[model samples]
Target: MSERVMPGRADGLITLDAADALWVDLTADSAVPTASAAFTCSPAHARAGYVLLGSRVVATVKASGGQWSVLETEVRRAAAELNAVRMDRQDLVRIGPFRGAPKKERNETTLLRWRQRITRELQELGESERAVRREGGGPSHLAGIDWRRILVERTRDRTARTWWLPRAVVRLLDVAEHTETRWVQAARTCQENTAVPEPPSHPRQARDAGGRQTTSPKGPGASLRPYNGELEGQLYSVLSGKPGTSRRVAGWVCAVCRTAPATVLDHCHEHGYVRAPVCQSCNTLERPDHLYSNDIRVANHYARLFDTDTDDWLRHWHRCPGCRARTTLPLPHLAAWTAHIACRSLRPTHHAPRGRKPCGVLRVSWTGSQNAPRSCLLTVAVDFCPSGEHRVLARVPYREAVERFRIWLAETAPAVAAAAGPDRLDGLPAQFRPVIADTSGEGLALF
Candidate 1:
C-alpha cells in the first residue's frame, strides 16, 4: 500500500489503498512513543460526548523502545518528577461526590473513608480525561483546558453510574491516566498559561511495589498517571498516527481437504493462548508426513469393518494424503477423533438439578486455524456436581471459560472440597477430552 500525504501537519493523510485507518495528528500537542515499542489497544469509545470503557484491558505493551530495565528507570524518573509537585495551597476544588441520606443517617467512618477514596479517584480521572486536546488554528498546549471548564464537563457526567469500568478498574485506570497527564502536562509546563502553576512532578524519593517512587502521587490520582506503556501510546496511535490494519487470524485451515478442523495450530507447550500448534509431522521431525496419512487410513479402514455392536466395537478413520502414501502408517482415528474420543462428555450435556446448584465449568481450547480443514478453534465448558453428572451451562470465549471455571472452583467446591477435599476433581483434566463438534452447536463432540 502507498501513502498519500496531505498538507502541513504530521497526520491527516489517506492510504492509497483506501484502508480503514486510525488518524493521529502528532503535529498537535501529544506524546508519541518510539516505533520499536510494542503496544495493545484499550476499549475506550466516545458516546454522548463521553468515553466508554470496556470490561477488560484497554491495551498492553508488547515491548518498549529500549531495554526493559531502561523503561523501568524512565518510569522511576517520571514518578519522582510528578511526586515533587506541591499540592500545598492549591485550593482543592473537589466535585462529583455526594453522600446519600442513608449514609448520613448511619454516620459511619467506614463510609466516610470510602467516599474520600472515591473523591480522590474522580480527581485523578478528571486530570486524565482532560489530558489530550485538539489543535485548532495552529497549536496550543492541551487545547488550553481551564480547570474551571473541566469541572463543568465533569459535573455534567456525574448524574449516575457513568465511568467506563467496574468500580475497581475505574479506580485503577483513573490513577494511571492522572499520573500520565500530570507528567505530560509537566513536560509542556511553560509561562503565559495564566500563572496558576500546574502541579509539577517531583523526583521520587523511594520505589514502591510497582518500582515507582514513594514520593510519587498516591491513591487513585497516582494510578491515573501514565505509568504503563499502553496508556502512554494512546494519543499517538489513536490521535496522530495510522496504526496497522485489522489483524485477522491467519488462515491455517484448508477447505479442500475436508479435515475435521481445517486448521492445525503449532501450539507451544506451556503457553496460555494458541500462538501455534504443530501438525503431526512437524510435531516429530523424524516422523514423516506420510505417517499421519497412514494413521488416518488405518483408522478409517477399521471403521469400515465395524459391525456396530459386541462388535459394538468403536472404530475411527482418517483419509489424510500424507499417510495415504504409506500403508504401514500408525493406525489413526479420523477427523472426528476429538469428538469421538470425548464421547463421555455427552452423558449429562443438559440442564442442572434444582436448588442446590451446579458444579464448575469446563474449559477447552481448540488450537487450530480457519484454513485448516480439521481446525476446531473452540473451547467447551460444563457446569455440574464435580463428582456427579456434568451439566452443560454455557459456551463462551476460551478466555472467559477459564475465568468462569476459576470462579466456580472458588464458590461451589467448598463442601465437596471440605469432605475428602484432597480427593477433589483437580486431576481429572488428563481424562477429559475436548468436545469436538455438535450438529446443534450444543452437543460437544467425542471422537
Candidate 2:
C-alpha cells in the first residue's frame, strides 16, 4: 500500500486505505469519532483526514478564483427580488380594485404584471450566471467546495496568527465571539458531510397549543403599552397649528438642537400638549421635568419661544459685586459655596459688630470639561457684609479647594466654640456638629 504524509504530528505517515477509512468514519458520525469506533481509527487520524478534506475543498474553490464574488452577487440579486415582491404586494393592497375594473380582472392584471416582472428578473439572472460560466466561474466549477468550512477555517487561521483570541476575530468579523464559535461548529458539521450548510433560521416567537403566538406584543416583560393613534393625531394637529414652526418652515431639522434631523414630536407629557418637533436625543432629554431648569441655554431659548424675559428661566450665572465678573455654577454647588462662606466669616480678619458674627452670601463657579469632573478650577466668592463687596476668595484645583475648605473648618472650630460659649457648643445644630467634629479631629461628644 502507498503511504501518505500527514501535515502535523512530525509528518506522520499513514496508508492511503487507512486515511480513506478515517475520512469515512468522520463523515459517518455526527459527533467526532473515538478510538473505539467501528472504523478502528483514532481521533487524531480522523482530525487529520477532516483537515485534509477541508483544505482540498478550499483549494478547489480558490482555483475558480472569483466564484465567491459571483455567489455574493447572486445573494444580493435574490434579496432585491424579495424586496421588489414585497413592494408589489403593498401596491396591490393600496390600489385595491382599479376604477372601472372588476375585482377578478384587477387581480388577474396585477398577477400578469408580477409574472412578467419576475420573468424579466429571472432572465437577467440566468444571463449573468451564463456569462460567469463562460469565464470559468460558476456553481458547477465550485461544486462540493463547502465554502462555509473554508471561510471559518480561514478566519481561525488569520485569528491564530494575530493573538488566538476570540476578540481579535470579533474585531475582524464584527460578530460576537460566541456566534463565531457556533459558526465554526456548524462549519465542522458541513466539513464532515462534504456539503454546503443551509442558512440558519431566524428565531421565532413560541406558539401555544392553539397555534397562536404566546409571546407578548410589548416584548418579554409585557411592560410597554400599545401606541394610541388618536392621541398621536391630536398632537400632530396641535404641532401643525403653530405658525412658523421648525417642522413647517425649516423642514425636519430639530427645533431645539437645530443639528440632527427631527424624528419625533416633542410634547408636554403632563399637560398633554405638543411642544415642537425635535430629534430623538432632545426628546429623551425633554422627558425629565428639570431638564430646562438645569440647562440655561435651553431654558432661555424656550422662554423666547413664549416671548418671556431671560430671567423667567432658571438663573445659574451671578455677577460678583466686587470684581463684576459673571460666575456660572450649578445648583448642587450651593451647599459647598455656603460652607466656604461660613468658614471665611470665622477668619480673624473678618471683623463684625460687638455681639454678632459676620454673615455673607457665597457664590461658586467652576471651569473644566463636564466629562472630567475630578479636574476642575473651583472658585468661591463671598459678599462680605457692612461693605457688602463680593470678591473671589479662593481659586484652586477641585481637590485642593476641598482640602483648603476642610483646613479652614478645622481652624474655625475654636472660634465657633468661643462664639457659642463652651457650654453651648454641645447645643449646636446636629447637622453642623458632625462636619465640625470630623474636620477638628475631635469626637462628636466634644462639640
Candidate 3:
C-alpha cells in the first residue's frame, strides 16, 4: 500500500514525507550532507535521523557515491545539528547523563558531585584540545572532540561555531570565566603530574573547650569560647531579683570617677572578690595589685579600707571664688577646680596688664600625716592678676591632681616653654623640669 503523506506544522514538526524532502534538500548541494543544511530541517527530523511513517522507523535513502560513507555522513550531520539546537535551548548543560539544577537550588552533596563531574570534563577537554593543537589543528578540530563545546555552544545559531573550551565550560556550569579557566589550568597541571586535583577547602569550624567542632555563633573568625549556660542563668536571676539589683546598680554613679555612670562590675583580681562598680576607664585603670606595688599612696588607700576612722580621700579643699574661704568639694568639683589651676598655669608668665610688673607666680604645696606622708594633699595657688591676689585654686589628692596636671602639661608645655624662654624652666618644680626640657631648647640648656 502507498503511504499517506501528512502535512507539517508551522512549529517545525514535520511529517515522514516532509522529513524525506528535508534530507533531499540537505544533501542536494553536495554528495555528503552539511550540518547547516541539516540544521535548517526540523529538529524532529534531525534528531530521529529517519522518517516516522505510522509505527515504522524508515531510515533515509543513501546518496549515490560511497553508500556507507554517505549514510554515516548524513547521520553525523543530523546529530551535530540536533545537538547545537539542544545546547542553545537547554536550561542546564548536560555533563555526561547528569544535568544539575541552578547553583542556588542544589544541596551540598549535589553541588560537590556536579563540581567533580565538571572538573573531569574540563580535564578531558584540555587533553583533547592539546592533542589537536599539537597536530596542527585548532578549536575547529575540537568541535567534534570536545563534548563541552558541543554541549554549551550558544553562538552556533549566529556564527555556526562553538566557543573556546574554557568559555564553553563557563557557560555550561554557569560560573565566572576566570573561575572556569582556573579550574581548567588546575586540571591540566594535575593531569601532567598524574595526580587527582584536591577538593576545595571548606571554612574551618570553630572548636569549644572540649575540642568538639561547633558552628560559630557569629560566622567565620568568631570566638570559639562556648556559651556558659549556668553563668547566664545566674546573671538573669540577679537581674530579675525582687530588689531589682540591676536597676539599683544602674542608678549608682561610678565609684572611682564619681561623674560618669557606673557601667562595669569592678573586681579585685588578687582576692577574687567583687568591689564597687565604676565606669569603663576607671575599671580598666584601677588595677590594685599593680598600682599598690608601684605607688605608696595607692597602697595606703587600699590599706585604709579596713580602718574605722578612714580619712576622706575624695574630699578636696579649694578657695571658693564667691565665699573666699577654703571650702570642701566633692571629687567631680575637685577635678574641675584642678582643671582651672592647669589653665592658669599654662598662661604666659611674661603677659601682664600694661604698667603692671610681671610678678605673677604659681605656688604648689603638699601636706599629709607623718606616718603616710607621701604628699597626699596637693594645694595649688596662683597670683597672676594685677591685684596680686594669692588665690588657692585646688587642694586635691596628689595622685589624681598630678595625673590631670601631666595631661595638661603634655599638650601646652611646648607653647608655654617657647614663649617664656629659659627663665621659665628655672622656676618650674624639679619633677616638671624634665617634661619642659624635652620640648624647648632653653629648657634643654638647664641640664
Candidate 4:
C-alpha cells in the first residue's frame, strides 16, 4: 500500500543490513525499484521489535515496554499455534493422512497397515503357509517386513518433507561406550556369585627348568615322600596297639596271600587305625566290616577266579575247607553228583554205625563191552533194610545214563528233580556241543 514494490512470490531476494533491519530485492519490475525498511528509529533498539515471516516484517514500538510485552506475548501464542499445526501435519503423514485421528488412536491402525503390506510382500515371495502363523516378532515376520523397502520408503518420505534420518545410530554408539562399563561390572558380579571353591592342596616348592623355584599344589602321596621314618614309627605304634598285629619290614609279603608284597598301610576305615600292612589285592577285601579272618579262603576264591599258577595256590591255601570243596561243575550238577554218590554207598543190611539201624543199600556199577570201549551197561540196584530185598532201579547203556539218572532222580527224589526245573542241558563247553548229540538235561544229567 505504501507504493514500495514487494518481492514476487516466485523469485525474490531477502537480506539483512546494519543500517536497515530488513530489505528485499525484487526480480519483477516495479515503480519503486530499491526497497528497505527499519523496525526501530533507535541505533540499538532493545525493547522495540519486529516479526519477520519470509519477506513480510511487522514492526512494533512500546512506551517503557508496556505495549511491546503485549505484542511479544501475542507473537509467542501465534508461534506455538504454528508449531502445533506443523507437528499435527507431520503426525498425519507418519501414520496416514486419511486416518483423521490422533497418533495414540492411530498407532494400531498404522501397524495393521504395515502388517498387511508385509504379509502381501511375503505372499509375493511364495513363502510357506507357516510364515503367516509365526508371531509378529519372529524371524518370519522380520523377513516379511523387507528392511530395504522400509529404509527406501522412509528416505523417500523424509525427502518429501525436506528432512533426513540423521547419523543418530553413530551418535548413540558413542554414548554406548559409557554403558559398556556396566557390562564389565555385570560379568565380574556373575563370576563372584557362581564360582565354586576347591579343596586346598599342600604346597610344594620345586625348581623349574630356568632354576627359579616355583610352588605347585601337591597331593597326599607327594606330602608323604619325605616322612618315611615318621611313617614307620606311626605304623609301629598302630601295630603295637592291636593285640595280634605285628610290625613287619618293607619287603614283607602280604599276611593274607603270602604271595604279593605288602605295600599299603591297611587301616580300618571305620576305626581310623592301621590293622596291618597288606598287598593291594588283599587290602581290597580286608576292610574292617568284612575283615579277612580266613585269609586262606580269600586267597583260594581269588585263586580260582584270577590266579594262573594253581600249584602254588594249592600248596599254600588249598588246605582251607572251602578250597578243598571248590569244584568246576555247576551247583545243580554238584548236588546231583553228591546224591548219586550217596546212593551208591554200600553197607551191611540193617547197618548201624554205633546206635541206629541203616535204611537200605544202593549199588551202582558199569559193565563195559570189549568191542565198544566207550559203550557200557549201567546197573543201579537198591536193597531194603533188614528184609534184604533187592530191587533194580535202572539197567541201561552208559551213553543213556543221563536219561536213566533223570528217571531215577524223578522216582527217588522227586522234589530234587522238580526243583531242577525244565530239562535243559547247560555248562557243557561250546566245544562239547558238537560231540554231545543232545543237551536236553543241563549239566545235571551230563555229569
Worst 10 residues of 1 by lDDT: 438-447
Tens digits of per-residue lDDT for model 3, 323-432: 11112222222333353444444423444466533344544444552123255575555556345566665666756664564444335343322232233233222321
Per-residue error at 300 for model 2, in Å? Answer: 28
- lDDT per residue for candidate 2 within 1-447, as digits (tens), equals 113323332112233334444433333332211121211222112211111121111000110222210111222232232223211111111111112322233221121122122223233456467456445442210111111111111123543211111211111111111122233344455456645432221122332223333211111111212222222223333554566543232234445545444445544332223444554334433332121222111121232321232221111011111000112222223224333443355322444577655345544555652224476565555556445466566655655544443444335443322222124323222321111001101110100
lDDT of each: 0.24, 0.29, 0.31, 0.29
Worst 10 residues of 3 by lDDT: 433-442
With candidate 4 superimposed using the best TM-score fit, by how many Å does residue 107's alpha carbon deviate from the native? 99
Candidate maximizing TM-score: 1
C-alpha RMSD between model 1 and the true structure:
25.0
Expressed as tens digits, the lDDT of each residue in 300-357 for candidate 4 is 1232322343333222221221212221121112222322443334434354678655
What is candidate 2's CA lDDT for residue 83? 27
What's the TM for model 2?
0.17
Candidate 1 residue lDDT tens string, 1-447: 114333321121122111111112121121211111111111111111111111111111111232111122222233233233322222222223433311223332111122233344444455445353211221111111111212222335555532211222222233333333333343344323535432222333332224433232222122221111221112111221233211110112112111111112221111111222122112222111122221111122122222122011110001211111111111122222222223234423335575433234332334442223243233333434465544433333333333333343335333322232223333223331222221111111100
| TM-score-sorted candidate list, best first | 1, 2, 3, 4
Error of 2 at 277 (Å): 33
Report the candidate with higher lDDT, 1 versus 2.
Answer: 2
Candidate topping lDDT: 3
State the TM-score for model 1: 0.19
